[model samples]
Target: MTAAAVVLAALGAWTDYPELVTLGLAAAATLLLAAAWLVASPKLTVVREVRPRRVFEGGSAQGTLTVTNVGKRDSPPLLVTETVGGHRTTVTVPALTAGHSCTVSYPLPVARRGRYVIPPVELGHSDPLRLLHRDRAAGGELVVHVYPRVHILASITSGGPQDAEGQTTSSAPLGGVAFHSLREYEPGDDWRHIHWGATARTGTVMTRHVVVPDEPRQLVVLDTGSAPYPSPQFFEEAVRVAASFCVAAERSGLPLQLRTTGGAQRESSGAALEFLCTAESSGADRGLAALADLLRDVVSGTQGVALTVVTGRVDTEAAQLLMSLRPRLLSVSLAQLVSPDNTLPARPRGVLTVAARGSEQFASNWNRLVLR
Candidate 1:
């Protein structure tokens, strides 16, 4: 307002217009008064509430905001903003009454996964004359959790582990370790031996049905530590691999578990794969650090039905871990599965590794190794 007054006085002197000087003086006085009132206005307090703290990406969150003016007089209009997954938006609010409150509600759309911090809500109070606006900082923060992206895969095999579920198809008639059921013999059935007693009682032909043994339960250890050249595309590829494995395993009647060196373990029903999309992003580990940490964690836990460690590279520590587990478990290494020259160290018997160019090729790659 003072600056405005000075400008008006200078213009009045240059133009030598008495009417212009009077108008400028009146405008300056009004601006000065508004500034004084704005300064003397009471401070406002704001609160933000987000429903369902943990939400999946592509989900909607209904958020409510409450504003209360602690001052003795009515406050200016307010604007509330909400940020989600790095996206920002502003909302206009009605004038709040002194010592009274008003509520505003909006929807927050989550487009990506990961833990995100919702920045503080801002309160903007502009004077009636609209010369300037004052902003006040509000307290309180919100933490949102987003899960991983899920895709459909026809076959799910733990790339590194033995079959956890005992599953067999009708085509593979060879004897299996897991016993299913026995029935009267049928023509063309395995002639090893027939159930003579049951055949005699029924006076008809039947056959034996054996429950297929499921492949070993596979534990996919993801190396999420920082990479030399960080790329979200790499992370996306890793997620696709994990999703493909989970879907394939679930379809094959196998139980699967997920663990990460960069984050917590995610093990639940097949449906839990949805949350994996939001794994945390870490830029702390470099070179072989991620592989070392993954190996250490594996030694600490013996639950891996089959260990399939998914990483960007095959390091010495990882090779050693596989060597150590070779005698006890069927360990598979999935590193840059799509790249040429992708190879697994030759040491442990029954250990197979394959390069997976993409989701469509995972099954073919596994089929090549499985036949071995």
Candidate 2:
């Protein structure tokens, strides 16, 4: 457009056309005015804030922008642009008196789990023709953490640890060492731990299920592999499942360790929750074998820790990997985070499988299976 305008002006001058010259001059003046409109930067102050800096996916939140004109004259109406979690929005800030201020409130994107960042609030203005515009940073950035939906699950009594803080977990005898004790083989139990001699003598499957009481500590594992999930929603359910256990452990004042296949390892709920907020499905560690070393390192620091593994779907390899932790862990729980729309997974042998379809169902099933 600028080139065309200049061409018209030059052609008119070359042809000595008065009307064309007048038209060209007018167009040139319009362009100059447009450029000048934005060039005149105004003095204003901007502050952006996210109400309740953190929220759950089920909750509502808002972003507030405060604009103040510090100049000697009144400020013109300006547009404010914001981006949060790759979501962008524009808001109109009305003109303000030099000493006065204007506040604009907009809803935040909180329907999903993420660590959202509201970049520096941008104060901008466009010319009447909308051909020229100006933008300037007004305020610092802010972060809003939206965590996964945490459903009230029946707190599973960890059967191995009695915390000094008055938290008592289950003390039921579970298989740990060979020859120390033997119990009937159960689904999801490790076949390697099977007592072959006792089974032959009793004509029944009996395996070592030993339990040694210790301090209250639990491990929460989340499968970040995309292949194991039937759908994206199922993976989100897995995250929520992991989040529930992490928070529950924190609330109960129990020692906790959180591990994700994406290589996130945290010992506290604050760190774990932050990780889960932005956790994504990945293709790493499809069989959860990568976590074996992580678990091994965990047990070295603490003995008789309870284990909970959260994932979408588990195949034989994954199930076997989970079962392998039974001897070292006080208890092993395989939580299949099944969405209501996804297909249910078949029960795997030699492991405790809790098919959680929803928050309510998970609460009931978890309490019944683990709390018992």
Candidate 3:
């Protein structure tokens, strides 16, 4: 445009045509106006929020951007570029009158498991003609942690308790087959015993935490070494499998020990799901080197705690390690995620092994094979 304008002006001067000169001067004035329009930056205060920062996989999260016009003049419309990890989305914020505020909301993707950081929005301004543009940083980083989807695989049965699948307690156990005190609903508590009568009377959901004799604490170990998995997908399935066990423990309202072959261990901690959100497959068989020490610690200190190992494949050495740890616990179970064509090594005689192709298969296989 500048070149064209200069040429028009030069040609008009040489040809002595007044019309060409007027057109060039008009074009230059328009360009200058566009620049001047953006020179007065919009004075705004921006606040960004990620509602329900922690969500399950396959679920979605929402982000809201609030912009307030703090200047004496009206604020121009803005273009906000929101970033979620490597993905980016741009949204338009409507103009706001002085001392007023407007909010722009957008969806954030949580389709996969892991931690994602949503940084501050980049506030953008442009002239109505869209010629001149500028952007300034507006807010701070908001973190969204995506957790594994816990399948409602196990049905809540009216049948006798029998220590309910995952983990348990002291001489006082977990169940409603026997009556106990009632309390309000907590996230990890089982939905089976929702004291309907009390819930109706009080208008609040409640559950009965019945106590029984001789409850067992459980240890769930995830084999995170890379060698066991033929592909990355199998490792992810294994993670979901491990998470299922932890969630079961939570539902049972008992103590659970969660550990990984990479030396990451959580003792009956409620953050097992959070820990697995960022769990990854590391290099070499050497990554499984810490499994023995981690298990040995649990074996020496605790008693009557059942053990379950979730893995991708059971190799000779891995099977041997599990076999050696079997004698110290009351029961040992193995959950393996393997490809359709892969052949698994022979599991120890007393240890139970359930093989599956994915998280769905793992859940189905566990119900059919172990529950029976």
The candidate that achieves the highest lDDT relative to the unseen native structure: 3
> What is the alpha-carbon lDDT of model 2 when measured against the actual structure?
0.76
Cα lDDT tens digits, model 1, 36-117, are: 8778867677778888776644576677888888888887777777777667778888887778988889887666666678
Ranking, lDDT, top scorer first:
3, 2, 1
User: Candidate 3: global Cα-lDDT?
Assistant: 0.78
RMSD of each: 12.8, 14.0, 8.9
Off by over 4 Å in 2: 1-4, 128-131, 160-214, 298-302, 338-351, 357-361, 367-372
Q: Where in model 3 is the C-alpha error above 4 Å?
A: 1-29, 153-215, 268-270, 285-289, 342-345
Candidate 2, residues 82-171, lDDT tens digits: the string is 887777788999878888899999987778999887789778887778877788887887888998988766555656435333322234
Query: Model 3 compared with the native: what TM-score?
Result: 0.77
Tell me how far the alpha carbon of residue 257 in candidate 3 is from the true structure, in angstroms, after superposition: 2.3
User: What is residue 129's positional error in candidate 1, in angstroms?
Assistant: 2.7
- Model 3: weakest 10-residue lDDT segment is 155-164
Candidate 3 lDDT tens digits, 124-143: 99887886788888899888
